[model samples]
Target: MENELTLKRFVDIRRNLGYTQVEFAKVLDIRNTTADIERGRTKLSGKVVAELLKQFKINPLWLFGESEMQYLEPSKTSVIPKVVTVDSSDNENMVLVNAKAAAGYPQNIQDTSWYKQLPAFDLPLPEFRNATYRGFQVEGDSMLPNLKPGEWVLAKAVEDIAHVSPNKIYVIVLEDAVLVKKIEKAPNSNNVTLISLNDSYPPYRIEPQQIQEIWQVNSKITFGVDATTEKGLLRQLQESMEELKNQFNHGKS
Candidate 1:
């Protein structure tokens, strides 16, 4: 059964790309669902083969089991050197990088001694457990309301460039500087688009080779807020709003 073997190879391709049936379906732009096709309820179409070639460069010969190679060209995946510090109990601690340290981070990233010297502490949060994380202090207004200056962002290391999801915020480590921005991958290209949330800034494209490392932003820790002053401001705003409402009602009456 040549057709059965082809179907099996097709399933293998999806698995190698780290996609589930549902995700593979979306990538293939399949209307009948990949689960149905995989189960032999629906036939795999020629369009799928062409799309796979265009997007991922899946080899037709390989898909049909004629060749041993899976892709015409190897997928471009980056392996970032992750250096983590462990506590006395053998648990990994999240490293803290201030503005000064962040500038030099790209150069010293691979050095174990350099990483150990940076401030490291165990974050008790369950979400950050069992993963290498780093806290970067936000510096600029590029991200605006979403991320503020002096706030610390906890991010997880993204090992592969292929795994960078579109429209997600990441701390991109470059040779010159480390930047925090939203990422968008250009289709069929090695260039990635960086978008700044602040309208004053414009989107820019950078080659994958220019990036040293990428970190997916998980959460932010904000400081320097006076809670009492904030509460008082809120009360004043509420009183002003009520006064405006009373004036409007009086005029109507």
Candidate 2:
């Protein structure tokens, strides 16, 4: 009963804390071992548990099953459940579209019937709750300092042309090719200009009618890893990424 209570408490805590196992592990200064905790195959040290109790002010009775207590006084807010359901077919060939693809334009090729035949594996998709992946591959060196050629980027599919923002990066399918570029809405017109991050390419404006599809890029969690022992490394990395983005924006301006 005590063990069951512990497991239940852990689940409750994790849910309330709004952390995926990976995020929770990072917060605990545990590197890449969240799966163990979730599986109940590993136990946290007494010191770590105590720290959690102290920091979170969790109900000890609920955690240890000393009493029928369920609620903690200083409660953490519940997180919205985010689940990613992948097709069952493409499990084995499930590749991370990390960089842009240098070959054929994935976005322009609308015949995804081939993908349906591949075995599928599901990953706990990242926290971009409102977005869906519209595949795009990298090309050229415009986004070079940050994105490399042959790396794949997952873009959020947008149905409306009005949804595309000015001066924001987007994955666009134009006729036979898909390209990633910064888009700027033309003043008082339906046309939009495509701008490349690299200065070697000249900016080109195109009418909305010329586009086949447009996708918004949300570049969070392009990589996955387990827990780590490094203190605040995740936080630091997030900050660094933000800083890099700002620097890129400044340079482009």
lDDT of each: 0.77, 0.57
**Model 1 stretches astray by more than 4 angstroms:** 1-81, 225-253
Give lDDT tens digits, candidate 1, residues 1-253.
Answer: 2388788988888898999888889989987458877777777678988998889888787888777767765544453645778889988887778777888898997888887656665655445676788778888899998999877787899977877887688999987889999988878877888999998999999878778888999777664443124354234334543565576678779
lDDT (C-alpha) at residue 70 in model 2 = 52
Clashes of each: 0, 25
Segments of candidate 2 deviating more than 4 angstroms = 1-86, 89-108, 117-121, 126-130, 220-253
Model 1: worst 10 consecutive residues (lDDT sum): 227-236
Clashing pairs in 1: none
Residues 1-253, model 2: lDDT tens digits: 1376687778778889898888878777777856676567777556657656777866565577765645544533221111223545633222222233323334424445534432222323333334455444476688766667644465666755656786567877665566788888867875678988888889998866567667777663322332121233234335545665677678779
Candidate number achieving the greatest TM-score relative to the actual structure = 1
